[model samples]
Target: MSHSVVVGIDGSAQSRAAAEWAATEACRSGRRLRLVHVGAAENGTRAQPESAEDCLPPSVLSVRDRIAAALPGLELSCVRMGGSPPYALAAAGEREGLLVLGSRGLGGFTGMLVGSVGLHVAAHALCPVVLVRADPDGGAGAAGDVVVGVDGDRLGDEVLAFAFEQAACRGATLRAVESRALPTGPYVTRAPLDQCEIRDSLAEAELVRLQDALACWHDKFPEVRVETEITAHPAGRALVEASRAASLVVVGRRTPALRAAVHRLGTVAHAVLHHAHSPVAVVPHD
Candidate 1:
């Protein structure tokens, strides 16, 4: 991956908010910041623009100037391209350390919490993708825990690694949560006593799994405070609720199988991205 943080620029308030967040992250990580804008027109269909600078929207220029003024020490660059927005952005993500975008862009419906472009990039990007929304109250970056959903599988190691790094960098608590749903359907026992016993057993097992998943990360980030939670709620709901007090909510996207025709974000990650109260990071894992 390139030693820089890349953000999609479109002139929307949400995109501006994402750019600001990306600037802060680039500063914290000591990486260059790249502002990329993809034109709505198809690559070959449109006439050649007078110049790359002329093609950039005024809002993109404004964002660049603001970041330059606010972060005088930061190395920044801008690029204008033409093609499908999601494809262009995903290609940039393949070579960048991180890619960030607004939850919704200028073309998005006002009611959409996350636009299609954001969802598509999160699903297909080779690197981690962060979706930031404009927080009018400016409370998203306030002191809070970094929460990650733990599935107790090998695929979750990448997610855990990212979460631990984020927590260590911010000197924040790391909350690892494992959520389990109770048994249902005809196979489930109907007796309350039996159900209660089964739930207790399941909870105990889940707690152990969660602890085991966090063991290695704890060793790696000894300075970061760690917390583990096992809940009976659905994973998506549990994560969405956890976002209320978290500065960042992290979820994993399973790598698509070789023969898979379509790529998509997992249900839990999809829900969190749509409803989480804070910025959300979707880390892809195999």
Candidate 2:
């Protein structure tokens, strides 16, 4: 918890919002805050004399200043570096507990706010990467609940661990949503009489599985309240809907080889990353 929360900064509104979110998180976790700026594009020429902050808008600089002054007791510092933004951030986060970033950074093509930088960092970071885009309301940390996506997938435990810990830290309710799809045409040859019954049975079994997975966690954090949901909807759509009211959405990143081959995440996590209103944490697991 004492490890620093590293946030990427660029001259963009979304990046500023991320910094604000990271500041609140650092305050809550009793961790230091590091504001990092990667001056130039990975392949582009470097900017002149001053640091990346000099190239940022005055409003962005003011946001950093305001946060520092407002949270005087919180340990905060800023650093300037140059390289590929994604690589630099991932490297910095190797030792840090979390890497926080804007859903969208500066300098992408039209209609694309979350440029290559955000995507690459999410895909490759050594630690968990959180993407934040604040709303007109009080932003993410005020949403009062943590929503996590759970399935019979490989990395679900890692995601659950993060969700429970975060809920414990915020004293918020933890909502675990499990989205299961029914068996397909060819696979259902033996079960013709009761497709609906089979689906219902599977759903009940999944709920039991989810509960069993969390049993120890429930004991570990007795103060945290947990609510469960089992839906017939697709994972991505289900999580997007849940995210509308969630403070944080937790999902898992696939292993390195799979990530490289599949372009970082599965369909559900990718969809939640783009559509979730809350800050989404991509926790990497084997």
Candidate 3:
């Protein structure tokens, strides 16, 4: 199987982290690493802006060189193009490559927040997009686990399967979480439960259902150590909180079937990408 990991870098510490993460992944997978930094020209217009000819920041190039040097055997290349990071990265992803990027950039102020590039790429990229957050604790160890959330959606299997493979490769534990929460719309019955006790009972039933679903996966991946968690909050929030201990958080993207009635991302997925303490993998629905 052929694979390539393309990372977006802007020369800041945050982007440097993203580059390092991407390079490490490439080395592990024995895939080439394409380190891309969007200069002003390759952005939206596609026209080479005269003034932006030498715009690729020297700091960014230096960072890329250092990372490439650190990883002697890794194949790394840095490109300076004009355009937005998200669009450029997405275009690269369309060729069936993984796109990795930092959640923020050089201006420490904005780096504290998830930038539009990370969000846009996560939502629209064709291949899996890994959005790395700035973590003071540094990167995951060889034994760190890759945790994933599953909800039986189109992309659920993709996320779980990918995480399983990654965990196996890294010799890390594999954990899966399924959330139990009432859907936004009411159940089939129009009759409302008048008593609070009745509502509480229904909630309990839902929790049991979620457990059953998780148990099914446990039976399937018996060799892959699995730990399950249940929470009552929104799916995204629950997953984001859990991400603190995870090396990577994996979630399914919106499938075509659900796109008509809803946007690709719900509130939770958005929150997870913006606030997750670890890197997030947005896997497209298969």
**TM-score leader:** 1
Q: Could you list the CA RMSD of all candidates, in the order they appear?
A: 4.1, 4.4, 6.0
Q: Which tens-of-lDDT digit does each residue in 1-286 have in candidate 2?
A: 5389988877576777789889988988889998887775333556432254455545556777989888889888776676667788888877787998888776766655356788788887768899987566634455658988877555356677889999998999999888866565333646565766776777788888878877888998899999888888898898888888888899888665554455477788778888887889988877
lDDT tens digits, residue span 60-169, model 3: 76877788689878877767655666677788766646888887865446434577677778877767888776567654322256778767333366667678767766
After aligning candidate 1 to the native by TM-score, how far in Å is the CA of 75 from where it should be? 1.0
Question: Each prediction's Cα lDDT score?
Answer: 0.83, 0.78, 0.70
Q: What is the lDDT of residue 137 in candidate 1?
A: 60
Per-model TM-score versus the true fold: 0.87, 0.84, 0.76
State the lDDT of candidate 1 residue by residue for 161-220, as single tens digits.
899998988889999888766565233655665766776776778778778767877999
Stretches of model 1 off by over 4 angstroms after superposition: 40-54, 137-142, 182-205
Model 2 TM-score on a 0 to 1 scale: 0.84
Candidate rank order under lDDT: 1, 2, 3
* Runs in model 3 lying further than 4 Å from the true structure: 41-55, 106-112, 137-143, 152-155, 181-223, 257-263
- lDDT score for residue 211 of model 2: 84
* Candidate scoring better on lDDT of 1 and 3: 1
Judged by lDDT against the true structure, how good is candidate 1? 0.83
